[model samples]
Target chain A: MGNSKLYKGSLNTIILKLLDEEGKMYGYEITQKVKELSKGELNITEGALYPALHKLEAEGLLDVEVAKVDNRLRKYYKLTKQGEKETVNRLAELEDFIRSMQQLVNPDWSIQ
Target chain B: MAISKEEVIYIDNYLKFLGVKYMDIRLEILDHLASEFENIQEPTSLGDFLRTKRSFVKRYENQWQKAKHWAHQRALIKRIIGYFYKPNQLFIPICIGIFFGFNATLLPKSLIAISFCISLIVPQCIHFYIYYKPEGIYKNIQSAKYILSIMALPSIFMYLMGIMAPIIKESPTVFYAYWFFAMVFNIAGLQEVMTLKRQIVKTYSKLISN
Candidate 1:
């Protein structure tokens, strides 16, 4: 697990992967999920989470659904067809990058 | 975790006080805060909670607002495209085709005026008509000044296109092209407003009903 500065670039990929698994999620739920999944190591800040969600929504990769849940409007986001395709691509790309980084950082480990 | 109506209202006001002017963004932020409040030991008093959030929001101020502006712009564009491409509107492009196909050059001043009126003026008049009502359609719609700014775009585009209308001395191609562009701009802008109105009418009512 990397620091937030390192995690910043991969936030979108993490979000998309989460959505792929979870079906639909709202802002706070997403932050909590990320924290829980990372064992409280990766806290998706409120500032970072909503803005990224909004950016994704604008990209047409995500679709928004607003429902009045208990008299409060809760906006849920789900991956569109394009977003679903994007998630697979992003995850593959992330995996490739991780593999490359590991090989670079631990070349001696592999030799042993 | 049952968010009450009062909490919802408080969150809405807090976002506003937090300098969130964009209503669409506010809605998302409101829901977020409410959800977080549900998790905390006590959310009834958010004064202390806000101190921590102040820094989080500060981190996002510039980037979040920039993204929101782009999102709104993209939304307006999507609305315009949606308006221009209803299956029934295939004739619109065909009309543009005829202008070029017929080599229409020596158009009368009245024809230009009529096109300007029908395309640019009428649709905006319709926009204002719906806008002035007590129950305006689109929830995302802002003040008149902002709406005017958005509404001004197609109008300005047409004005620039029309400038070419009088300059053309030889071929009517340029003249007709100007008319075509102007007409499209007005109708497309109008259709965008109309589509928003329709969505609001259809969707907003259902929200309350449900």
Candidate 2:
């Protein structure tokens, strides 16, 4: 798991990347997916997840669908057309950050 | 394990008790809580687990109150831009501009002035409604009121220009400024009217209670 502070910065990108790969997802599904992907090392806390989802939805980068699930209404969020484009840009930007971090941490090896 | 129907009803009641209205945010909060209950590794009653999860109350409250305001402001701006792509919606605003453009010369000057004042005052009244009835209003409607207030800016400017319109009416170069301002305001008012803030609550009897 990465540092909490480090993960916070990439939260939006992580969400966009996830929605880019997976179809629409609800809030809990998203948190669980992130935990699964990171081997339970990175917990996308609810405080962080919900706010990011709302912000992204407000920014027109996400679309929302309200459906009845388990006798309750669930909000399913997916990337918008603009969001799809943003995923590419954000993923590229994150990859660049990872490469830079690798270079900084492993000075002896060529940064991939 | 799935949350039982009774637990779901209790959660709904608790959320309502905590003042979580907006159907969208309320539903999300409920879904998250239910999903969390299912994932609890330890054998714990759903109600017991939920009782300790203070975050639910805080989240549901913050989402519709503070976060909702932020999202509303952003949505207003984005929707304005989005209007461009939806020509059907764009057509109404453009039609308003065109109507005022041609009518400025034909309509009585007094009537034009009256419209300018109405445009300015209507939005002010909307702000007052939200302020007056802060409670019992849906978050969607409240934000819609705020949007009405925002879209009113052009009308405010148009009202300000009413004084200047007559002075420049004779000049060919600047005569259209009044009409332009009027059109901008009219378009804004047209948008706000859709929010139904002005209509008496009695009139919208079919409207679902927020």
Candidate 3:
């Protein structure tokens, strides 16, 4: 798995970005999507994913809908308008951090 | 392979047997379990499969409880504070203040104190009943219980004010201030209950429709 600690701080932004792309997703779907997109390198555990989701919901950054799918109730979360704006800001911040880390780790290398 | 309806019940009962009491939380976990269960190639009894996830039961409960507590507390405070700024909402509390303020001079001290205490007690009882009664929608929902606990703040205020009643009654100014504060507290509590009731109704309707 990818270094969980390294990715921990970016979890919420990852979630927002995914929701922005997919429109709406449930808990398991979010975790599975992360694992698939990262090629099984990052595992978003239940312990970490839920608290972040609940916190975002509380902050009015996300809204929820419940639907019956295949004989069970599933809750799907989507970003609010505020959440959409916040996602752009968080992604920009994450990109900057990644850029800074790349410079520190390999000063001679240039993506450009 | 997708599990049968009976298998779903088995998963639910196993969780309940392990003491996962909240229906809302359990439903979320159930979906996760079922989704993953579909991927297993080998034959496995539902109970045995659930045993592997036993460790998560406590962690999920504790994490959810803490998050729910914080979220509801913040929401309650925001909604209460909101009442003061919106003129339409502000009108109710202002009317409450006016009623208490006008009665302060006319009513006897003991009567006013008793009335205030009852105002706090009645809602405490009603909130408890509506949230926990056997058939209530909130009865098995963990998050609703957390919200109800925060809704109990007014009764706590009542208890403190009751203990200090002798001192407060001695000064009309202090008495009036306490009543003013109590009015806001009581109104906030009522509004929370109403809002919670509406949310619970909407949620259960969705759950039932499914």
Candidate 4:
């Protein structure tokens, strides 16, 4: 498992990227998806996932729909039009960040 | 491994006991907890699962409460500003501004006081109604109350500043500014109330119907 602190900065971008790919996802599904994708290396705590979701929703970058799934109400979040646009921008920014980190940590690692 | 409705309610009660009292947050937490329980490969009692997950639940509830405080403030401001830019939503605020402008000179003190009272009281009434309503989705939603209080703030401020009445009477500029702000805020508040009601109704309509 990677250090969680190392993943913290990219969490929102990661979520946006996931939603961009998945269309819509609920809270539990999102955490599980992240864990599965990272092979359990990056566990998104419910504490972190939900606040990020709520912040994005507040920013109008995400939209939510509530549905009765099984015996409970589930809030499913998806990218809004703005969110979709933001995902592209955020992904690009994260890519730039990764390249910068790679250059700083591994001088021999050349992407070009 | 699907959780039963009874188990869902039990989880909700446990969350409440853990200080996650807001219905909306509690509902979301309950769903997450239920999902975790559903994923368990081995048969486990609800009590055991809750005991194991108590720390996580407490952590989330605390973080959510903090995040919600800021999110509520930001969303309220965003919605209020967003309301004016939408063409369809422009009508009510325009009418309010026009009405106040037309009546500015002729409007008596009693009428102004009454207007302020209405603006102050209406949002509160809506909040109280929803908060106390049986099975109302917003009954325990803290954001609803937070938004309503924000909506009422302008009225409360203007009312308290009735001390400005003497100054307002002497300066038409001040009076105009006062009425303009009052008109804008009251109209925005009304719009927020409508939006909040629409959201609650739309989000929970299925549950209501069931």
Candidate 5:
């Protein structure tokens, strides 16, 4: 698992970015994707993921649809129009943060 | 292993403790988990299934907590809004009485006295409403503020009018009436102010304690 403290801040962005790419995903699938993308570096527990998803859904940022997948009804969440817009904004914010961090770490280095 | 009913009840109580009030939502979650467990056709240990279910419940509980918090906040706001109006029902009659009382010269003295009687009844009615009707702390606090505002309006109007125009000629009777009205106004205003202060202190203390 990635640093719990660092993961706390970035989890929402990570979820949004994933939904932006994948279109729609179930709870379990989201957990798997995060692990795969991070090469198992970041392991999101069910405890954290569900609450974030529900909160985002409540805030009108995400829309949910439940359907039977392999005879079991699975709740899938997709980014709403608002969610998509939020994703772009969050991504830009994260990118800017990363750039600033890089500058701080290597003050002598300059981007080409 | 088949999931027992007791396990389901345990889960239900846990969710309730976490503030999940909707029965249908809780049942839906339980059904989903039960189905997942049923799908494991091969004999699996109850302990393993319980472990897996625990993880699932934990994930969903996080979402429930956020949603519940939002709901609780919305409820508090609604209760406060309700309080603003609960006391206004009393203030209206008092206002009408004061208006007609001041204009008694244009009407019968009996009518003015009747209006005063109605005004007195209104405050008692308000007291009954405040006591009998159960309200949340936020709502009670808000009602107190509303009552204060209502009390201030008449005094403010009378004070301004008295300063601008000496409606009643300077006499001992008129002076006594003026002092009496001023006392009533002050008492009503102070009652509301004190109530509001009490509510504010209680609310702040609750927030701090939490």
Candidate 6:
């Protein structure tokens, strides 16, 4: 349930960051990647993933290529030029968020 | 146990309730879920399979609602921004064009050339601005049509004041050419406005169906 809220806010950034790291990925592959990375903590269901992909494509942030994979047509998404720039910006923001969370959790932690 | 065709129909209807209008995508997703049920070779009963499928469908429906809400909010923000930007985009250029074009006769040759250049540049700018911008195509075009109607007032004033009479008598062909061009621009603007209205209606209908 907590993961769902995080997924809602960070869906675009996560998709963008993944595409930035991997050249292109299919919908199922994306879900699997998120699950694997989060060690089963965050699961991206099909319902949540596809619409976000579509929205990002519409916004000119992502480009899609449909291809036949193992007798199934899969839509693969990759970062557009704008998406790449957006990924960098989103990553910095996420990093800042993580830093802030760390400060809040460990109030006496010293700066490295 | 095998799944019944009625279950597929039920799932489809549920998706329809969730506002998924793309038949192809909906069918594909349904098929995927059905196949996942079919893959279970063990002695699982139909009821258990359906229970699992129902949970999956519920999860999907919730997610779909969230995504739709997000897209709607974003589109709304874009529309608001486009509304404010539309006037500046349309009016500024047209005003510059009229300012320069009206004073062309009084100005020197170089100034006349500059005025004509401004006149040409302004229309082209309006064209590109309306054509390229992702938002407010319909609104901008309607506003342009209104502006064109206002523009006709000047020509009417010229006729009433006999300002165009000397030109009409001195060079009838040149006067006809100017009149023809004005009519064409007015028609073009009106046509653009009509087309945009059609597009807006089509887009809204699609949004509703989806």
Which one wins on TM-score? 3
Which wins on TM-score, candidate 1 or candidate 3? 3
What RMSD, rounded to one decimal, does every model reach?
Answer: 4.5, 5.7, 2.6, 3.3, 13.8, 13.3
Q: Rate the local accuracy (lDDT) of all candidates.
A: 0.69, 0.68, 0.80, 0.75, 0.59, 0.57
Off by over 4 Å in 6: A1-3, A109-112, B1-24, B27-210
Candidate 1 clashes between residue pairs 3 or more apart in a chain or in different chains: B105-B172
- Displacement of the residue B143 alpha carbon in candidate 3, Å: 3.3
Which of the two, 2 or 4, has more DockQ?
A: 4
Once fitted onto the true fold, the runs of candidate 5 whose alpha carbons sit more than 4 angstroms away are: A108-112, B1-47, B52-210
Model 6, B1-210: lDDT tens digits are: 434667666656765665554443454455555545555778765456655655555565444445434443344334434433687445533554465456654777566545444543454445445545576433322222332332332234334325655774577466444543443343344344355446445543332243
Tens digits of per-residue lDDT, candidate 3, B39-139, equal 78899877788888888776888877777666766766777788789877888777877778766768887787677677667767777777778886676
lDDT of 3 at B60: 86
**Candidate 6 residue-wise lDDT, A1-112, digit = tens:** 4648855888889999999999998776787789889888888876677778867865768875645433233456899998999899998997787778778889687234
Model 2 chain A: ten consecutive residues of lowest lDDT: A65-74
TM-score for chain B of all predictions: 0.63, 0.56, 0.84, 0.70, 0.28, 0.30
lDDT of 2 by residue, A19-78 (tens): 989989999999999999989999998888887887887777998776667666667899
Worst 10 residues of 5 chain B by lDDT: B136-145
Model 4 chain A weakest 10-residue run by lDDT: A103-112
lDDT of 5 at A79: 99
What overall lDDT, based on C-alpha atoms, would model 4 receive against the true structure?
A: 0.75
Candidate 3: Cα lDDT at A2: 41
Model 4 C-alpha RMSD vs. true structure (Å) is 3.3
Q: Which ten residues in a row have the lowest lDDT in candidate 1 chain B?
A: B141-150
Predicted candidate 1 versus true structure: per-residue lDDT over B1-210, tens digit per residue: 676787677776776788775555566666777778778975357666655676665555466656545554565666546546777767777776675454435557666556545655676676667677677534443322234434565667546644555575455566656556666666666665565556545544544454
Q: After superposition, how far is residue A47 of candidate 2 from its true place, in Å?
A: 0.5
- Candidate 3, A8-97: lDDT as tens digits: 999999999999999999988999999999999999987788889988887778988888888688789999999999999999999888
Check candidate 2 and list the clashing pairs.
none
Worst 10 residues of 3 chain A by lDDT: A103-112
